[model samples]
Every structure is written in C-alpha cells, then in structure tokens.
Target: MAAYSVADGAEVARQVATLPDGGSSDSLCAGAWLSAAGERQAFNDDFTLLAGTVPGPGNKGKTATAFSVSGGSPVSTGPGATASDDRAPVFQSGTSTLWYVTGDRHLTSRDLKQPSAAPADHGTAPGQSFLLAGDRPWVRAPLEVTPDQAAVAPGGTVAVGSNLLWRRTDPAASFAEQNVEPAVLGPSLNGRAPVPGSEAMPACAARLWFDDLSLLCNARNTLLRVTFAPDHSRVDKVETLIPEEQGLIPGAVLSPDGRSLAFLREWAGTVDLYRLDLSAGAAPVRIASLAAGAPTGSGGVGRDVRVIAWQ
Candidate 1:
C-alpha cells in the first residue's frame, strides 16, 4: 500500500532494510552536503571553497560525482549522504564560522572551518552527523508562519528575506516568537508600495535580503536596493529597476549571490530554461532548452518556470 497507518504515537510504519555499504551502492564519506537561503553560503571542499562541481562517485550504480544545481555550486559529501534539490542554508548561532543545511529528510549542519573529510558520526544514529552542536533543534519555534525566504543574519538571527520580518528564539524564554517586528526596508513587502502608474506587475514573491549596509529586494519584476543602519534600527529604500531578461527566472530566484541567475522563458510554444550572467549586463545565456509543446500565437504555450539551489 502507498499509505499505511502507524501504531499510536509512532512516526514510522515500516522500515526499509538498508543495504550493506558495499555492492555498487555505497561510497566512502557518502553523507555530506550543504545549503543556505538568500545568503551566499559557500560550499567548501576540505576547507577549500568549491566553485562549480566537485568530485566522488558512489559505489552504487550512480555517478555520484555529478552535483548540479538549478543555479549555485555544489560539493559532494560521500556515501549514504542524502541528495537534495532544495538547498537552503543557515549558520550556527553565536558563531559566524560554520554553516548548516535547512531542507532535507534529515536537517544537516557542518562546520565551514572543519576540513572536508567525511564528517564523523557525531549524531545519535549510526550514519547521521551532527547538524548543530546543541541540546535541541537549531530552529525551535511553535511552527509559526513559513518564511518565503530566510537569511542568517549577524548576532545569530535568521532574517526572513521577504516582508522584512525577523524572528528568534529567546533561550531564557525557551520558545519561538511568532510575530517578529519588521525592519521595513522596502515598500514591496506585503504589497504596501504605491500602485505603479506604469506598465508593471503588482509585485508577488518579493525577495528581500540584507548585506552589510545594503538591504536588497526584488519586487514586481525589478530589483530594489536599500541601505541599513548598523543597529538594524533605520532602513532606506534606494532605487529599483528590472533586470535584463537573461538567464533569470521572472518571478523565482536564480542565485541570491547575484553572480548568476537562472530563469524559465517561453519560446516557440515551450518553456526553455536559461541562465542570466549578471556580470555581462546583457540578455541571459542559454544553458539548456526545456521540453516544449505546440506553438501558440507567438510563443509556445509553456508552463511557468521554477528554479532552486541544490545541496
């Protein structure tokens, strides 16, 4: 059966027997991958930063060496390491040193400063590694509202990129805050910006981020730049404009690093994916053509595009 009921108070219904670590299925050091959201979480190999694809193929009948992202760079964690299409990252609190992974069956964390050797089994299970060295989950809250985008901020704060909202767990109180006060860096948040009198969109899925004194946001179809005070007390929106339609998604995020972006565009009745090179300041570069169908009036009737980082 695809679905089955478990015993009362039990999470697992049936356990699939794990195969032994040899026969064409296991790779040495197989369970290490990383991620971050809205922030440039660098992927390091043996304490060295990885740019694009790194190495290692698992003993399993799979080319473990190939780690491709819809947008960013990736590094391999060895055998039994979980592969992920969604790679959102966050750093450990009280330290700017190590980074952690957010989305996956098991929440994973690693020290950026630690050499990229197969992480030791510091976790409670046999293969699981220590995510964040703490007594509890890194993010402990009352299952509050899901964030559209999140970034690890200074002073151990996870900054929700959209809505300019902030939330943190007060260790003394031992609970997560639901309604975090707003830093209010842009008008696009919550669609509070004045209605545009021009031919523009109503701004959906705004991407808000903080960097140094710069608070950046991408709204409607344009990127808005801003600045913040040292105290996180004052914020100002500077300017906004649409980026060139290169290899960038119109509504989804390509690369938060702003170095490169990937987008799905419709052409000849099919949705094709492309990558925009922000460094070139021109139209997007074509990475690969997505499958498309019959052509409509001018272009193919393709579905919208979606892109995500990988771990």
Candidate 2:
C-alpha cells in the first residue's frame, strides 16, 4: 500500500501485508473498512474475514465483523438479526457511527464502535447475530438506492443518491431533493486518453460529497459543486468543476477532509486510481493502478476496486 502526502506531493509506498494468494484480485477488492480500533476490517480472505492489528506504522489494533453479505438476508454479527442490503460500510469513530445504504434504499446507521478485533481462528463462519445494518436508516430513498451512494455530512446531514441529489437531517428525517440542470463545462480532460470505442452517451451515476454548506456530485460525467440554502431548504448554486468526460468515469470518492477527490478510470482490464487535490491548484496525480477483471474467487462478483469509504 502507498500513502501520498497531499501537502508535499511526496509519495511513500510500503508493503502493507502479503494478501492470501488463494483469491483473485477482484474478490480481494471486495471491501476495506478502517475501524476506530485502528485496525482495518479488510476482506480477510476470499470468503473468510480476519481481524488483527495490521502490523505497521500508524495502523494497529484489531478487526472484527462489520457485517456479512454471504447467504440469504445479508446476515450480520451486528446483533439482533440486523441484516442489511449492501456491503459499503463507513465507520466514523467521532460519532461512534457505522453507516451503510440498505437494500431497501435507505441510509441506515448505528451507534457501535466496531467490536474488538476478534480472533480470526474462530473461523470465518459468520456469527448468528444476523444484524447487518443499523436498526434505523436515517435517510430513506424514494427510489432504489445502491451501495456507496450515500455520504454522512457534518451538522447532522445525510446525502443520498437517487437520480436527484437528496438531503435530510440525521436520525430519520424527511428528505429534500435537489435537481441539477447540466450545462457544458467546456471540453473534457485535456490530456486524458479517451476510452477505446466510446459509447455515445456516458452511463450516468451520481456520487456525493457533502459538507455543512455544500454538496458535490458527479452526474453525467460532470463534477458539480453545490451550495445549499440556509436551514437546509434547497440547493442554491451548482458550479461545475470537472466536466463530463467523453467516455466514462466509473467511480469517485471524496477525501475525509472533503478537500480532495479520488476517481477511477479503467482501461481494458486494468483500473487506474487518481487523486485531485481540490485545495491545491495542482493537476490530478496518478496514484495507484489495480488489476480489474472477471471475478472468480470466493465471491464471484465485486466492483473493480471501487472505493466505498475513505477516511
């Protein structure tokens, strides 16, 4: 794994740990959640999960069940048979919050610091607890909601995806929807090599980044920054930063500080990860490259190194 310092543009790469050689890289990319315990609840293996202090600088402590997706109902060790519909899990220790979008199209949360990094030897057998999601999903979707389409913002606001950008207060509040009328933002990436055999209209999906006063999303390949009205009434302004690409931009996630943006672009079978330092007026830096292809491991299906949570 490599850690890039945004401040100095210095890249430091180190070996995190040798992954189990048994699984394909695609399934190995299933999910990675950094627990408040300071250990990462990474996809331990193809089908099993293990929690231990990732032995390294700044990463220590343990791992545990962040919920399981295998079998029916998406059972969780989250207690009380609290099952969920998705795999993108975000753990924020500050609020002791665990958040994820439910299969029923709602953004749910619970107040539980991840369980202590338990012994992996107990076997990857999922506990009978069966609780996968938080008891109450704070945000509900008028339409189907997908994984990694929700983000928790400051000041008790939750932003979710549903074609239109929606926002609501924390603890199960009504959602206020905002529509964005896309306008041209000049041509696409200046030096970006276009995807081979481009499709006419890029498949549009929205990924959101929300702060107290602003929300940012990528729709129709355009990255738009929006400001909400006082008292969370409505969207007041929509400004385009990165315009729609000619080909496609599959995924994006905002940095923890919400200042930088990381996006993925796949060529043939390899996926490239890039980071845009929004705070710095610097060009987006090429960070890491990953292998993405047909899945064949324990979990035969998973995103192409799709980044679900960042913090």
lDDT of each: 0.34, 0.38
Backbone clashes in candidate 2 total: 6
lDDT score for residue 113 of model 2: 41
Lowest-lDDT window of 10 residues in candidate 1? Answer: 25-34
CA deviation > 4 Å runs, candidate 1: 1-144, 167-179, 183-220, 241-258, 265-270, 277-288, 291-305
Candidate 2 stretches with Cα past 4 Å from truth are: 1-136, 146-148, 165-206, 231-233, 279-282, 291-303, 308-311
Encode model 2's per-residue lDDT on 183-289: one tens digit a residue. Answer: 11122233432222222223233455456666555454455565656654445665666645552355566787877787655444555567777763456666765
Question: Which lDDT value does model 2 have at 235?
Answer: 50
Task: Give the alpha carbon lDDT tens digit for every residue of 132-158 in model 1.
Answer: 212222343112222224443434444
Number of the top-ranking candidate, with lDDT as the measure = 2
| Model 1 residue 51 distance off true place after TM-score fit, in angstroms | 23
